[model samples]
Target: MIEIRNLTKSYGRKNALDGLTLSLGHGVTGLLGPNGAGKTTLLRCLATTLAYDSGRVEAFGLDPSQASQRTALRRRLGYLPQDPGSYPHFTAFDLVDYVAILKELTGREHRHREVRRVLAEVDLTDQARTKVRKLSGGMRQRLALAQALLGDPELLILDEPTVGLDPEQRMRFRALVSRLGESRTVILSTHQTEDVAALCERVVAMDRGRVVFDGTPGGLAATAAGQVWLSDKPPARSQLFWRTADGRYRTLGDRPPGAEPAEPGVEDGYLLLEVAA
Candidate 1:
């Protein structure tokens, strides 16, 4: 549903996206990267909000540069940017209702059904009348997600969606996303490896504005297959181990002669990429 070819973006002399080329088909795909990894830049381009200096980007076969085609693409695209905020005077219901109108500009009363359904879908029906300022952080995030789904969009691009959410809320949001992925393309950008492992059918790892890895969850796990391990004590080379709260450690590289195999996880694979970069 998303395609980027030789896309390049520059902020003065610094390059944010450098000749990046990748194609995304239908399903949930995680755009994984560290801070300033061009994940946002790429998403903005795909969202048709930010223009790139060079190269071509197409979303569902519609070129972003074409004004006539852009609106059609927008009709099918849903985006939940990080830190999406609501106006102080707008209630949760009001905010969602507004988005519903934009999704179907002339529907008026017909849009009300969409607005109500989305509010309940995100479990905000109880707080529908409350002003945005009164809702808790998690509620606002849910509201943002509700609006993203307001259009029954075929392609959803969410950036760092789970940030600031509590564990329970995060799980619920993940479940919602998983449900959406069953029929459409859901592209999410996040640095949290576990988030990708949880919901995405494929993971795309980027660093320094370039894609370094793009594959299935199992393929990602294989990156650190033999590199993750556990030890009775912290290894002398402590850089490889991630310290745990229970006085245990998860280390990378060949285990010491007597050390047994430790459980490999998303973070282990993540670290392998970090180390490689």
Candidate 2:
């Protein structure tokens, strides 16, 4: 549903997205990256909210750079930005209502119905009248998601949708996002490997504005299959090592002396990749 080719973007001299080429289809796809990996820049460019320096972006068979096409594309998509602004004075319902209007839902009754349905989908129905300032971080995140679900768009782009959410809330968010991706394309951008492992069938890892890896979650983990090990103490030769909850050291890289092989996870593969870069 989306095609990008050699997409390049920059902020002054530093490149945020450089020679990034990606294509996405139906179902959920996770975009994984570190702080400067350009995941957000890619999302903003794809959402038609930010212009790129060069290359092509086609969404739903239209070039987003063109005014008419971008508007048309936006109509068929929903976007939940990383920092979705909140109106302190507006209640949850009011905030979603405002977004519905922006989406061009003219009929009052129909718009209200859609808003209610979306709020329920995100489990924010109980907070419908709660002011934005009064809602907890998790509740506010759900409210942002509610607005994104207003039109039941075919393409959903969520940037860090689980941020500020507790474990229970994150689980709820995953369930809602997974359900939404059943028959549509969902591009989820986040730093959470567990979120991607749980919700995405395909995953892409990015670094320094470029695509580092793209494949199934299993494929990602496979990159570190023989490299992950566990030891009683931290591995001195390991590229990355951390003390586990059980007091053992889980290490990735060249296996250390007395270390036992451990099954690699998505995060393991990702860290190994970043370390290599």
Candidate 3:
């Protein structure tokens, strides 16, 4: 479990996280926000990889601001940054093994077994002997994920974990994350609204570095309930309108004449919140 209170982080004059407060427990929670909304800043603060200007962050009853507690928290934490850089020359097995060592998995035999287990978990067992430079973008992403899965971390912080993954790989990731959420805390930050709808029990939407909406996926969808409409033509004044596969324009805003009310989805609610913010 983790708790953040009045957290604020700044870069020069702009605040990345502005008086943000949140609490996270078991299961998967989807973090949704636009550019500059502070999702990465918040995750970095929680992962103990970045310091904040002000506020309190307590994870597993440990204060990350303190050196000793930060070290202790790192032992139980798994972090997949937005851009998890890769070593071009290291083999998949070697890369994961190297991370396992950093996590203090000292014994060679045990660490190697862990490395293999995580590699298989990410469905990269066949490519274990291949060099990172030879792997595709998706495989490299999976390799990053494999390293995060090492040590069976208690808290997993994943920022765009499905970035380069194809549909099938994304589905596999969903399954794995869904299974992981059964017992541990996983904070998944992503732009994919469908992923949130499919894998998250809780959805938190952010805007201008503050939480604009925090509730269940259904609850988020419900926020746009009566505002979504399907019409043959775009609404006159609607700012959020898009063509759906059904050959109708799905519009969000005031009702348009003869437009049928369509069921609102997570993406609809998220966009509505963005417009409101």
Candidate 4:
């Protein structure tokens, strides 16, 4: 388990994370929020990639501030930074191999075996020898994922892992992560709400660098229970729609008091949560 107590990050007078605390148990937890909502900041602090001004962080039963403990924790965790870049002219295979050594996952032959395994897992075997600069944006992301899988980590922290993939590739990646979470912790920070509803058993929603909600998708949808309605037409004062074959406009909004409730969607639930904040 991962425990974050009284976590905080300050950039001079500005607060990136304010008194954040959370306990991460085993399973897939969607870190849901908009950009600059401290999702990356929190992930970076957990990965020990960046330092926090104040907080106590314990990961996999080790304190991240201690050198030995930090080393141990890193071995058990796989992190993919928001921006995964490498020096120009380095081939995908070459860079992955280098990361394997840095992780110290194995020696010569074993390292080669591990590198080849992850490269194939990320579907980059065909372009393993291709230079990063020459690869497409999606391919570079796959290479980054390859490196993250090098150590077969127990905890995987993925920030927007499917951003560049095509629909097919994204589905494949999501399936792989879902499988990985069965035995380990997979904390995924993403702006994609569909990904959360599909892959996460629970979600941590943040706003302005603070956790505004944490619960299951169903629970989140429940937030809009009485505040949603389906309208035959949009507000009369607003512009009219072209209508979709059916004459009724099928618009959605908060139902008026004493009126029947409308079925709420995840998007509607999310909007309600955001507005309430």
Best by TM-score: 3
Candidate 2 vs candidate 3: the TM-score winner is 3
Please list the Cα RMSD from the true structure of every candidate, rounded to 1 decimal place: 1.5, 0.9, 0.7, 3.0
Taking the tens digit of each residue's C-alpha lDDT, what string does model 1 give over 9-125?
999888999999999888899988788889999988888888899999887779879998998898998999887967868999888888777777457776877888888878899
Q: What is the lDDT of residue 91 in candidate 4?
A: 88
lDDT for 260 in candidate 2 is 97
Lowest lDDT sum, 10 consecutive residues, model 3, at 233-242
lDDT of each candidate versus the true structure? 0.85, 0.92, 0.95, 0.82
lDDT of 4 by residue, 182-225 (tens): 99999988878888888889889987778999999878878777
Clash-forming residue pairs, model 4: none
Please give the distance, in angstroms, between residue 103's alpha carbon in candidate 3 and its true position after superposition. 0.9
Off by more than 4 A, model 2: none
Q: Superposing every Cα of model 4 onto the true structure, what RMSD results?
A: 3.0
lDDT of 2 by residue, 1-277 (tens): 7999999999988999999999999999999988989999999998889999999999779999999999999999899999999899999999999999999998999999999999998888898998999999889988998888878999898999999999988898889888888999999898899999998999999999999999999999999999999999877655589999999999888888999999999999999989888
How displaced is residue 123 in candidate 2, in Å? Answer: 0.9
Model 3, C-alpha of 173: deviation from truth (Å): 0.3
Winner on TM-score between 1 and 3 is 3
Preferred candidate (TM-score higher): 1 or 2: 2
Q: Candidate 1, residue 103: CA error in Å? A: 2.6
Candidate 3 residue lDDT tens string, 128-186: 99999999999999999999999999999999999999999999999999999999999
